[model samples]
Target chain A: MNETALKELLYKIADDQLILGHRNSEWTGFGPLLEEDIAFSSMAQDKVGQSHALYQMLQTLGEKDPDTVAFMRNADQFHNCILVELPNGEYDFSLIRHFLYDTAEAIRFEMLSESSYQPLADISKKIRAELRYHTLHANTWVKQLGSATEESISRLQRSLDSAMPYALGMFEESPFEKDLISSKIFGGEQALKERWIKKIEAVISQTQLRLPDWKALQPVTGGRTGKHSEYLQPLLDEMSEVFKIDPTAEW
Target chain B: MPTREQVYTWLEEVKDPEIPVLSLVDLGVITDVQIINNEVLIEMTPTFVGCPALDFMKQEIHETLNRHGIDRVTIDVTFRKAWNSDLITEKGKAALKKFGLAPPPSRELFTELDVLEHATCPRCNGTNTELRNTFGPTLCRSIHYCNTCREAFEQFKPL
Candidate 1:
């Protein structure tokens, strides 16, 4: 197994969870409804915790400690897809992003459950089970609001269309795609994207919203290689502010 | 030299911080206990990977064993035996119901939403319950509303 490839894989997955988890936390007080507020907050806790577990796995492979790896990294050092790092625009936009992003993650972890790396497989199984509720929550809302009324439907439709390009960016191939696939560490991004498309389409078909033509949407790539949008650096700075102020601070 | 059974007995003093009535042993997060050359090694798994109660539970385990006068204690939290609701004991299930939270149904036949969507209300033992939210106040719970009691309750979600 290529150690570098494995670390790259772990970093991207962990970074995605951490960044999205932070974005989810931003919804704690701002959800359209109280239930949605609690839902996003709970999911935020779950995502951040899951990322910490992944970072621990990385530490065993000779990476830095979870706290340093999470809090000390700059935007260019992260490997999360742009979809997760983007600002949570509105309730509709956030809902659409949640629906799209978690759909892929649910499938990604499911595939990783069978990973040849025994430890990854073990944690993946646990994470996969927890993600079921996330996808369920996302699908329920997408279906309801996607079909509800003129304003609700249009709001979601517009967000879905705007988010589609970045959502497709989620499958931006890793430089080690071949090694990860050949070594069976991951089933590969293409396969994950295919499964993701089917799952999201199944949910979207039940609603009034339209999924843009897959072939026509150009993916907003480069995040996997540490090239991120202007949005990421600010998020990183804000997230690490307290930690940077006092690196040795304890709760 | 303490027996493995004795160590488990001492562990019974450690309860889940969230659910005071339940012991870690009955909750089934305590996966294995071994006595190795006067040292005690315990392996445990979390109910949910993100469960906030995990660190507190780990601390409680160490404190409880230390109080038992076993100075050499090693507690390893792993996903090796990944916990599922099925790992919980019948005693634990009863304790949860008694604590006013519905116990998760067996996951053996848990493929559909129906199992998760409907829970037997702990208050009235009524099956007429609607799932209010899948994500609850805690990672391990789900919110449900029972028509019989006309009150909302939480369930120890089946994972």
Candidate 2:
């Protein structure tokens, strides 16, 4: 297997979880309902925890420790998709993004569970089980809000339209797409994207939300290659502020 | 040198931090115990990868062994065997019920919401319950409300 390809794959997936987990934590005190608050916070914990596990795997493959890899990096070094780094925006937008992003993630992990990389396969089996709850939560809300009222339907529809491009960016092909697929480290981005589209469409069809034409939408690419938006650096700065204050501080 | 059985017996003193009634041995996180040349090696897995109680549990295991005069303790936490709710021993389930949390049901597959949405009420032992939230105060629990008991309770979620 190509070590570079494997590390690239691991870095992007781990970065996505870490950034989105931080976004989910932002909802802790601000969720529209008590359950939503706990839901996002719980999911945040799971995501961050899952990312740490992935980073540990990377360490075994010769990367830095989880904390250093997560906190010490600049924005340009990150490999998360732009969709996760975007601000939570509003309840409707956050819900929409959650619906979209987790839909893909659930399927991604399911595929990775069968990965030829034994360690990844082992962890993915555990992660895939936990992600079932996340997708369930997201799906329930999306179905409800998508058909609830004119205002809710409109809000979710607008967010869905606006988020489509970035959501598509989630499948931005890594330079090692060929290597990852050939080595069976991953099933490949395009394959995952196809499965993702079908899954999201099935869920959205149950509600009033309309997915944008797949071919018509332009993907906001480059995040996979460490090309992120202006939003990423600030988010990273805030996330790592405490860690930077005392690098050796023990909790 | 302490035998593996003796080490396991000593570890029975260490309880899960969150659920005091249950010991780590009964909780089934302790996957293996090995002793070689006066050194003790213990392998364990977490109920949840992000479970906050994991480190505390590890510390408790070390302290418990240390107290037993087995000072050379090495603990390895891994996903090699990967823990599921089914791993909880029968004794552990009773402990969880006694502790006022519904024990997770034995499950073959967990792809649906049905298993989570329904749980027997620990207070009333009634099946008439409604899921309030799939997530609870902790990662391993889900909140449910029982019509019979008319109380909100947490279930050690089936994963």
Candidate 3:
């Protein structure tokens, strides 16, 4: 693939992490439960770290520095998973997003951990370490809330019901999935999606909630294609406001 | 290259911000220390990510080197590879055992997260323990409860 296309694709992945991480960080102190709070916070930190590594990879192409890539891009240029761009709903909604997104993330990282690209594999290792905790956290909630207080169960199912559509966006393809696979930059994306669905199905079955027929969801041209929900603009506004104060200032 | 005497002298002054008996170098947390161009570049990994003492340690590293008028020092934390208890030195292992948290039979003998890898009662060696919760006073450790010892102790969770 050409350098421009590669950088763009890498930026999509980096920006997705950056934006999703920003959204997750917003709940740092506010999570409903303390352990979950720390868990969420830790996941957010790891995502930022992963973004840094991806930006470093992007730098190999001699384009925007990590900060500029993080701060300068407008919403139209971003290609993160659509699921990450959605607004945080109720606590259950956040957990739903966490469960769905993180489950996919775990498989994604698992594949990347073995990527032919050394730096990417190395980072995938670091990311997967923290993601294990995140996966556990989300799974625990899926089990607990799926079988917890009436309110908790209801909220969880409702969130899962609504978010299920957007969740499909997580697997939406990028322009480089084929080359990324061929180059062994990371394994085939479909293998990741397959594991993601299977793993989530197994876990969700352990709860009181009925798994949404996986067949019901259809892919949407969300963030993967540079389109995003209304939430992205506001999220980008808050995250970049600090860096934009003096974009050139070393952070 | 640091002479053994110089390295020992440096290690003596650096203490873990959480557990003072432990020195950063002694903990084997400092993997490689190379002094070049009158500047020291130190590579170390934290016991866990989000380790609060790390920021303090970085500051301590800078101050320690500055005290020697070593113009500059860079303390780099690598997370490419996870830091395992095996990374701790024998003396560091002894310190843990003496402190009542028995060191693993030996680093090599311990499988990746051998059941023994979890927190042993720093008060009494107990295999049957319960994690009261995951978070602790610090991010690097977890608060675990030993039913046998009837004590609450901090266990350093593997990163």
Candidate 4:
């Protein structure tokens, strides 16, 4: 594969992990319960780790260090989805966001597990191992909140209603969709969509929450092609604050 | 230069910060210890990502190797495979038992339940236990309670 095509692919994967990790980190001390706080923290760290591995892989392709790649990108230059970047509105909102992202991530990772790219394939395998926990955690919460006290059920219903509209926009494709599809870097988007639909449908039915009868949210365009949400700018500002102050300083 | 046996022996002395009776190596978090000519390269993985003991583990690994004069030390942390109860060595299990924590029982269903499930008390060996909570003092475990003992205990989580 050409160098540019390769970088595009690596950056897209890295960017998604990086941004989603940021959103999840916000739950560290704030999750509704202690177990969830720790559990959510684990997912956030795994996402960061995925970014770290992808960044290290990108380093082999010859541009920047993982930290630089993660912290230095411009707001419009990020490739993560809007679903991942939007703020966590409530416990239910966070669960919905996680439900969408992780379901997609698990499917994406399963496909990437067989990627033609050996290094990517290796990382994908490792990432998938951790994805199991992420799946269990998210699914458990959705089930509990859906079946819990009326306060919890109502809150969850409202959160789901509010968040589902933005959650569908996470599937925006990149420039190398065809090459990735043909090369088997991962499975086709159709396969990903199909699995995601089946898994979420089962979870939604179990929760007694209806998948809104409305049409799925339209793709906002450009995230996979390196354009991102306005929410990204402030998030990046906080995330990169230290790095920008002194690039040579180590934590 | 120390031989591979010596490296292993030295690593054995490095106890897990959280579970003192158990060494990080015994947990299989440190998968391999090699002495290549003069330097030591330690292949390690965290039981969980963002493990609070990780910094201390790395530091101890580095310090232990250097103190014994193994030249240099490099620890490669991998998270490719999430750690589970199976990784805890027999010695690690023994240590947990000594510390009055329930070691994994042989039952397959025992493996299925995490801290979220009931674990018999190590002190009283009672099965009438329920999950008290999941946040323990460290990231590697969670707090559980036993009605028999009426005391809270830490359960080594299958992260």
Candidate 5:
């Protein structure tokens, strides 16, 4: 197994979870309903914890400690796709993004559960069960809001259309895609993307929401290679705000 | 030498940091305790992967044993095996009820649609209940309202 390929895979996975987890947590006090608030908060905690675990694995592979790596890094050093770094716009947009992003994430973890890397496979197996509930939550809400009222249907449709491009960016392949695939560390982003399309389509088909043409939506790429939206730097600053105050202080 | 039973009893005194009424042992978070070379090694698991209480719980566990004259201790937090509400002891269930939180059902069936739908009201033990929301203030809880007692309560949701 190629060490560089393995590290690249871990960095992107860990970064995606951390950034999106922060976004989900922002909905804590502001959810349209208290239930949604709690649900997003739960997912936020899970993602953050998952990222911490991955970061710990990275530390064993000769990287900086999880705290320093997570808190001290500039936005360009992050490998998360742009889809996760986007602001949570309206309830419709957030829900649509959650549905799109988590659908792919669930499949990605599911594929990695069988990876040849024992540590990655072990963690993925544990994470896969948790992701099951996330996808379930997304699918249920999408079906409910998608078909309910004309206003809700329209709102969700608009968000879905807007999010489609960035969601495609989530599958922007890592430069080591072939090495990851051949090394049996991952199945590569293209395979995961193909499955994500089918899974998202399955859920969307149950509702009034329409799936847009994939060929038409130009993918918002560059997050993998470290070019991020303006939104990311602000998010990183906010997340590390307290940590930067006193890195040595034990909280 | 401290016996395994003695360790278990000591752990029973360590209440869950979130829910003070229930001990960590009663909550089923403490899976095994072993005595090796007079050092206590604890094997424990979190109720949820992202459970924020996990670190505090570990600290409490260490302090509880340490204050009891066991200085050398090691705690291993493992996620290879998941936790379910069925792990909650009978005492823990009663404690939750007395604390105004409905205990989760012990069954393994956890379909997302019906996970929180059937919780009996903790206050009045009412059978007629409606699920207000599947999410609550904490990861282990959900909100439900009782038609019989006309009250809303939290249920320790089945995992």
Candidate 6:
């Protein structure tokens, strides 16, 4: 088996969860409604905790501990897709991003549940169950707001349009994608992207929102190789603020 | 030497930090207890992956067992197996109901939309209830309103 390919896949997944989880948590006090706040926070906790689990698995496979790996890494060291690192622009944008990103995550975890690696398969099985609720939340809201008011519909449509390129970036294939696929470690980025498009379209069809022709759009890639937006470095710096305070001290 | 049964009994005094009415054992957080050599090892599973009250629960367990003369305790939080709502004991359900939060439905009956559609009201014992919101103030609950009593309450979500 190609160990480097598997590690690359794991790093990207873990980084995506961690970054998006931090973004979700930022809505704790800022959500438009109380229930929305709680919902985002709930998902935030789940994603971050899930990221920790993946990092722990990485540690077992010979890496630094989860905290160090998560908190101490520079933006260029991260392997997350660019979609997760963008600023949560507004409730509309954030919601749209959440819907887009989590749909991909749910499908990704589902595919991973059947992986040849027992540990990855086991963790994926457990995580896939949690992602069900996340997708349910995202789908329900997107469907509701997408069809609710002209204003709501228009706002969501705008957000959707702005997020599409980044959403496509989520499917950026690694150099070792073929190795991972042939080794049965993962179903590969192309397969996951196809599934994600179908799932998201199914939800969008129920709403007034439009699913753009993916082929016409240029995907905002580079995240899988550690190149990131200007926003990622500041976010990483903030995330590690406390941990970096005393790297040697246990809190 | 405290027998395994005695340790279980001692654990009964350890309440879930978030839900004070229910003990950790009844909440299904405590999975296994073993006495090996001079140490007592207890396995646990969290209701949610990032359950904020875990540290407090662990501390409570340590204090509860230590008070009972078992100081050599090791708490292992395991995620190898997923936790299900079915693990909640019968007594735990009753406690949740009495504490003004509806207990979760059986795991077998938790179809996709069933959680929002059906929740017997804790206050009026009424089947006529509406889910106010799927998200609640806490991690494992959802807000609901009883049509009969016109009272809003929380229901522990079926995991």
* Predicted candidate 6 versus true structure: per-residue lDDT over B1-159, tens digit per residue: 778898999999999877899999999989899999978999987887767888889999999898888889999877656577788999999999999999998856766765667599988888899887777877788888888988899999887
- Candidate 2 lDDT, A35-83, residue by residue in tens: 9999999999999999999999999999999999999999989999999
| Deviation from native of the Cα of residue A9 in model 1, angstroms | 0.2
- CA lDDT of each prediction against the hidden true structure: 0.92, 0.92, 0.71, 0.74, 0.89, 0.89
What's the C-alpha lDDT at position A27 in model 5?
A: 97
| Candidate 2 chain A, poorest ten consecutive residues by summed lDDT | A208-217
Error at A220, model 1, angstroms? 0.2
Of the two candidates 2 and 6, the one with more favorable DockQ, higher being better, is 2
- For all predictions in the order shown, the interface RMSD in Å is 0.8, 0.5, 3.8, 4.2, 2.1, 1.8
Local accuracy of candidate 3 as per-residue lDDT tens digits, B1-159: 454357546755788887776678767678777777766777887665445567788788778766766556777777565565567677776676676544434435433333433566767676677765444455445566788878767665454
lDDT at position A143, candidate 1: 94
Q: For residues A200-219, write the lDDT of model 4, one tens digit per residue.
A: 88888897676775455454
Q: For candidate 5, what is the DockQ-based docking class? A: acceptable
Report the lDDT of model 4 for residue A213. Answer: 59
**Residues A1-251, candidate 5, lDDT per residue (tens digit)?**
89889998999999999999999999989999878988998889889989998998899899999999999999999999999999999889999999999999989999999899888887787687678778878988999999999999999999999999999999998888899999899999999999999998898999998999988889999999899999999999999999999999887
C-alpha-based local distance difference test score of model 4: 0.74
**Residue B94 of model 3: what lDDT?**
66
DockQ for each of the predicted structures, in order? 0.83, 0.86, 0.29, 0.29, 0.48, 0.50
Worst 10 residues of 6 chain A by lDDT: A125-134
| Fnat values, candidates in order | 0.76, 0.74, 0.18, 0.18, 0.46, 0.38
What tens-digit string does per-residue lDDT give for candidate 3 at A168-211? 77777767777777777766657877888889889888888876
- The true-versus-predicted C-alpha distance at residue A208 of model 1, in Å, is 1.3
Cα lDDT tens digits, model 6, A41-153, are 98998899889888988898898999999988899999998899999999999999999999999889999988998788877877877777788889889999999999999
How far in Å is the alpha carbon of A239 misplaced in model 5?
2.0
Report how far off residue B136 is in candidate 3 (Å).
Answer: 4.4
How accurate is chain B of model 5, given as a TM-score from 0 to 1?
0.94
